[model samples]
Target: MKYQDSLEQASEKAAQVKVFLQRAGLAAHPVNYAVCYDYISGHHAALCTAIEHKLSAKTPFDDFIMADLYSRYLTPANPQQEQLLQDASGIVSRLTGYTDLAAEQVADYLQQLDFSLLQLQQQQQNGENILSAVEQLRQQTQEFRSGQYQLQQQLEQANQQSHQLRHELEQLKLQRQLDPLTGLYNRSAMQHQLELWFTEQPGRRVAAIAIDLDHFSRFNQDYGSAIGDVILSKVARKISSYVQSSGLPVRAGGEEFLILLPDVDLRSASEIAEQVRRGVEKLRFVSARSKKALPKVTISLGVSLYQHSENWYQFLARTTDVLTLAKQRGRNQVASETMLALPA
Candidate 1:
């Protein structure tokens, strides 16, 4: 009965060691075989020494026992132990193959993850570049808008200056076409007016009258030139007041004047010219220094009606010739080219 109890206690202790080895993740078959053989062969000191070394080396009990069995008992001469070592070697080789395959799979997975991270980083960089380009475009647009606004303001100022210049040009043109002393149309203005009228309405009844201040040089000698100027001004004012209401009066020369009458025949023009001569003969001028009545001013008039075939120059020449005849015949009288003889 005591032998049975000792056997049970030894069996229980061996079972506890097996459990401890298995829990430590060591091979069960190799460790159990090695421990049993060592005990049966009376090499208990070898087992104890191996366990102590394994404990010192921090090795699992089962792996320590397996290494001991191969080193001490599993040799080529012992065929049974060699066969057991071969089985253990087979199991370890299979386990190494599985471990190597698992390591390869893990390495491949890590490589794929690295490639994916690289692609994501590249996409992020592209997005940042696009944002930078958008900001640059916005700044350019703002600058362009500012430039356009300044251009618009400059254009408006230029337009205003152009308008003011045009108005000044018109005033200058008017001053050039007017006689400063008489306030009437000058000779150039008269010629231009006749030409414009003829072009606009051809074959119209138009008449030209030429008038001369009778004895102007004699009046300038007798009275001072200043008094003579007053007399001439008075005569010009009377003639302008009479003719400008019905026709156009122009200062033709120093002491000569011309009138242009549109839609008037030679008979009506002669009547108007005689009326102007009488009006001028009745003009009274006063000397500024003396404050006395000056001599009466008289003008001789000549008239010529425009012919459709004649230009402005030919008509004026004919009227001037008649004016010469009137001056030779008598002063303060009117004559026409049709009624007078040609100059000798």
Candidate 2:
């Protein structure tokens, strides 16, 4: 349904999609087919860009990865969430109107009370009229105080509702931004963190370390996906352990992960990358069913500095290219921008 290609265009793209699926050893299932079709058609800029990076790096695509891509980019928003969002917007608007109206009413009441006070001062010699005016003034003041107290109570209630709404929204946002398997940040969260860092301090240096588990697809094939998932989760935790609170650790689909370090230089990032690589290499896993030791898991990492001139995707792409270089030189190694400048 997402595709709107003409018959001829669809045919051409389908052919290309076939070739891509064949190359990746992925079956032409609906999810995989749609993802490849989207890529070939050049629609869905984000999906295209992601596929391009993977292709450039010769990363293997599997059923899980294909499904992930579709879910992340092509899947429709939850209807319930959409309805909730609309309701929240309406509530906020009404709250704003109520607050504005309360403020105006209070101001008008204060102005009337001031006029009454002035009249009382000027009519002081008219004792009976002054007394009557005083009584009127006292009643008006009491009404104003009571109204003010009521509005304050309403405002407090509104604030509480607003707080609760925000908390719920924050929880929802956190869920959306996290990878379900690894419990790490997802690409959307990563992009947002990058944007926030730049927005807060323009031209601030951000170091990116792109990491990929070497031969992870083969591992999944050998050990089965369930085991692969466990490995992924553990490795994610190990990677996250090294990143400070200032950094963001992300699961960038499949076996790929990215660490973003704001205000960090290339040297420090590379060191962190090396530490992550070594830590993953040191990890040992055993099959739950067989009690046999599994193959050692290792990671290849690429470190790069973000350039102010380029978008986050471009910066990530360059870092991914460096990761490809690490893969080329040998897996379980580190590559950097300096290496990017050198010959392959």
Best-fitting candidate, scored by lDDT: 2
> Candidate 1 regions off by >4 Å?
1-134, 244-246, 341-344
- C-alpha local distance difference test of each model: 0.69, 0.86
lDDT of model number 2: 0.86
What TM-scores do the predictions have?
0.58, 0.69
> Which parts of model 2 have CA positions greater than 4 angstroms off?
1-13, 16-75, 78-84, 100-144, 196-205, 262-267, 289-292, 306-311, 337-344
> Model 1 lDDT vs. the true structure?
0.69
lDDT for each residue of candidate 1 in 1-344, tens digit (9 for 90 to 100): 21243766667656765665565555456435445444433446765676566567775443323533544544236454455456556545655664565566556545655664565567677764445444544565565566556655655665565566556556656765777777777765776788888888887788988989988988888986776666666677888877756478887755778889998888988988988887887767776778988777788888988887866656776787788788888768898978675543
> Clash totals for all models, in order?
0, 0
* Tens digit of per-residue lDDT, candidate 2, span 163-236: 87788788788888899999999877886788898899998999999999999999999889999999999999
